[model samples]
Target: MASTRIGRHVKAPRATVYRLLLDADAVARWQVPTGMTSQVHEFDPREGGAFRISLTYDEPTDTGKTTAQTDTFHGRFVRLVPDAQVVEVVEFETDDPAVTGEMTITIDLADADGGTRISAVHDGLPDGVSLEDNELGWRISLGKLAALAETGELP
Candidate 1:
C-alpha cells in the first residue's frame, strides 16, 4: 500500500474551515478543476455518515471533441472532532474491480498566525495509483478550500 500526506496553512479560522468541509454545496463548489464540474451524490458530515463525489473532467481535444470522464468515490466518516479534525475511510470504484482499496483520510486543523494550519494524510492508497496526481489534486482542493473560507467564493 502507498500513503500520501499534504499540508497547507490557510488564512481562515478553524471553525470556518470545518464548516466548509461539512457543507456539501460548498464542497461541490471547490472540489474540481477550475473549469470542470463536480456533483455530490451523497453527503453526511457526521461520524459514521457516508459521502460520495462525482468529478467530471471536461477538456476540449484537438480533434474538436471533448474528453470527459467521471470518477465516483464512496466513503464514510470514521471520526469527527468539531473544528479540529476528521477521519474518513474511503474506497474508489471503477469498471476494473482490481483497482480497489481502502484509504483512511485524516484532516487536521490548528490555529496559525494568519489563519489555520491544515494537514491531510491519505493512507492505505493502492499501489497502482499515482501519488503525484493525488498530491496535486489535494493541493488544488485545499487551495480552493482556503479561498472559500476566506472569500466565500470558489477558486
Candidate 2:
C-alpha cells in the first residue's frame, strides 16, 4: 500500500533513456543499487513479456530477501510506450511473508530543456522494505541510469 516517487533530469534524449529502460544489459548495469551486482536471467522487452533478475550483494555478510546474498524477482511488463513510459509488475521470490507481494513500477519519460526528464513511481511496497531504503536505492539507480544515458557508461 505504500509508494514512492522520484524525479530526475538526465542529459540524454528521451529515446535513449527509453531504450535503456527496456534493454536487458542496460537494466543489469543501471537498475542495481550501490554495493550490488545484477544478473538478468531472462528478459523480453515488450508488453506482457516476462523477465527475471537477481541482485546480489557484494558483501558476503549482507542478507537478501530470497537467499543468503541475492534478491531474485520475476515480473511482467504491464505496459510499454516507446520513448514515453514503461510499467512492470513484479514479485520478490521470498519465503518471508513481510516481503511477499506484487509491486508496480512505472517510469515516465519526457523532453526537458537540455535532455530528458524521468519520473519513476513505485507502488505497493511490502512491509519489510523501508521507505528510506527504497528511496535511496532508487536515487542511486537513477543516478546510474543518467550516467549511462549521457556518457554510455555507468558512474
Candidate 3:
C-alpha cells in the first residue's frame, strides 16, 4: 500500500519527453537503475498495450527475484495521453513473498519555463523493495531520461 513520487524538469518539449518515455529502445536505455543494464523484450505504449522488460545487475551476486542477476517484469499500459501522461499496471515476475501484488505507475508531463516538467508516481510498492532504494532508483532513471531527451537521440 506504500507509494512514492518523483519529479524532474527536462530541457525538452513535452512531446519529445513523452516520445522517449514510450519508445521501447529508449526505455531500455534510460529506465534501468544505476549499475544495471536493461533489455525490453516487448513493448507497446498505447492504452491496453503490453510490455516486458528485464533488468540485470552487473554484479552476479546482486541477483534479483526472477533469476540470478536479473529482474524481469511485465505490464499493461493502462492509459496514454499524448504529450501529457502514461499509466501502467505492472507486476514483477517473482515468487518472493514480500514482493507480491501489482503496482500502478503514472508518468506525467507539463510545460516548464523552457522545457517539460516530468513527474512519476509509483503506487503499491512491495514490502521487499526498500523506500530508499526506490527513491534513488527513480532519481537515476529520470536523470537518464532527461539526458536522453535533451540530446534528442533515437536509440
Candidate 4:
C-alpha cells in the first residue's frame, strides 16, 4: 500500500470550504479532475453515512477503473467534525485485484492568513494506482475546489 499528502491554501474562509466539502452538489462540481465530470449517486453528510460517486472521462480514450470511461467509488464517512475535519473509507468499484482495497482519505481544515489551509491525506493506495497520477489528479481537483471556494461559483 502507498500513501500521499497534499496541501493547499484557499482564499476563502474555513466555514465556506467546509460547507463545500460536505455538499454533494458542490462536490460534483469541484471534486473532479480536469477533463472529467463527476456524478454523486448518493451522499449523506454525517458520520457513518455512506456515499457513492462516479467520475467519467470526457475523452473515451482514457482508461477507467470501473468501466471503459468511468471510475466509480463508494465509501462511508468515518468521522466528521464541523469546519475542522472529515475522514472517509473508500473503495474502488472494480474487479481488478490490483486495485481492490480500502483507502482512507482525511481532510483537515484550519484558519490561515486571510483564508483557510487545507491538508489532505490519502492512505492505502492499491498497487494499480500510480502515485504520480493520483497526486496530479488531486492537484487538479483541489485547484477546482479552491476556485469554487474563492469565487463561490462552480469551476
Candidate 5:
C-alpha cells in the first residue's frame, strides 16, 4: 500500500492544536484542501467513533472519482490520545475501483519550541492517487490548521 507522511509546526500550544483536531466545527473550517469547502455531517471524537465529511470543489463542474463535484468519506476513530495522537481508518465513498480501499491516517502532536509540532502519516493510499498531490493537499490543509490554531482565524 502507498503512504504519505508530512509534518508542520504550528504557532500554537499542543493542547490547542489537539483540541482543534477533534473539534468538528474547526475541522469544517480547515480540514479541506485549498480551493475546496467542507461540511461535516457527523463527528465523534472517541475511540471507535464514526465521522463523515464531505469536501466539495469550489467549481461546480469539478468531478472526482467518488462523485460529481464532491468527495465524501466516512471513518472510524481507531485511537485517540489526549493532546498527543489520533489514528483513524478512513474509507472514501467512491465507485472507482482504483480508488477503493481503506486509508489509515495518524496524526501525532508534540510540544516543541513553544508550539505544537504535527506529524501526519497516511497509509494505504489508493493506487490512482499521486503522492505529490496528496502531500500538497495535506500541506495546504495543515497550513489552514496552523492559521486557525494560531490566530483563531481561517485563511
Candidate 6:
C-alpha cells in the first residue's frame, strides 16, 4: 500500500492541538475549506470509536438553483493518546470514478519550544493515486488547523 506523510510545526501547545483535533465541533470548523461546510454524523474521539463526516461543497448555479455536492467519510479511531497522538482509519464513500481508497491517518504532536510539532501520516492509499496531490491537501488542511489553533478562528 502507498503511504503519504506530511508534517507542520504549529505555534500552539500540544494539548491545545490535540483538543482541536478531537473536538468534533471544532473539527467541522477548521477541517474543511472556506465556504464548504461539514457535519459530523458521529464522533467519539476515542479508541474504537466511530466517526463520520459529511461534507457539502456548495457552488453558485447560474440557473438560480443552489447546487451542492455532498461526500460522506466514514472512519473509526484506532488509537487516541491525549495531547500526543491520534490514529484513525478513514474510508471514502463516493461514486466518483477517480477516487477510491481507504486511508489510515496518524496525527502526532510533540512539545517543541512552547509550541507543538504536528506530524500527519496517511497510509494505505490505493494504486494510481498521486502522492503530490495527497500531500498538498494534507499540508493545506494542517495549515488550516494551525491557523485555527493560533488565531482561535476556523478556516
lDDT of 3 by residue, 44-102 (tens): 88899999999999998796879988889999999999999999999999999788789
Give the TM-score of each candidate: 0.89, 0.98, 0.96, 0.98, 0.97, 0.83
lDDT of candidate model 2 versus the reference: 0.97
What is the alpha-carbon lDDT of model 6 when measured against the actual structure?
Answer: 0.79
lDDT of 1 by residue, 1-155 (tens): 88889998888899999998889999898667554578899999899999998777666431111123666788999999999998999887664544477889999999998799999999987776678877888889999999999999865
- In angstroms, what RMSD does candidate 3 have relative to the true structure? 1.7
The runs of at least 3 residues in candidate 5 whose Cα sits more than 4 Å from the true structure, single-residue gaps closed, are none
* Model 1: lowest-lDDT 10 consecutive positions: 59-68
Question: In model 1, where do residues sit more than 4 Å from their true spots?
Answer: 60-68
* Number of the top lDDT candidate: 2
Name the 10 consecutive residues with the lowest summed lDDT in model 4: 146-155
What TM-score should be assigned to candidate 2?
A: 0.98
State how far residue 90 of model 4 sits from its true place (Å).
Answer: 0.4
- Per residue, candidate 6 scores C-alpha lDDT tens digits across 1-155 of 68898888999989889999999988887777544578898999889999988767666431111224665778999999889999999977765444566789999999887799998899987564578866875776788899888989754
| Candidate 3 backbone collisions, by pair | none
Ranking by lDDT: 2, 4, 5, 3, 1, 6
Candidate 5 residue lDDT tens string, 27-115: 99889997788999999999999999999999887777677888899999999999999999998899888888999999999988889
Q: What is the Cα-based lDDT of residue 58 in candidate 1?
A: 64
**Cα RMSD (Å) between model 1 and the true structure?**
3.5
lDDT per residue for candidate 4 within 1-155, as digits (tens), equals: 99989999999999999999999999999999889999999999899999999999999899999999999999999999999999999999999999999999999999999999999999999999999999999998889899999997755
Candidate 1 vs 5: which has more TM-score: 5
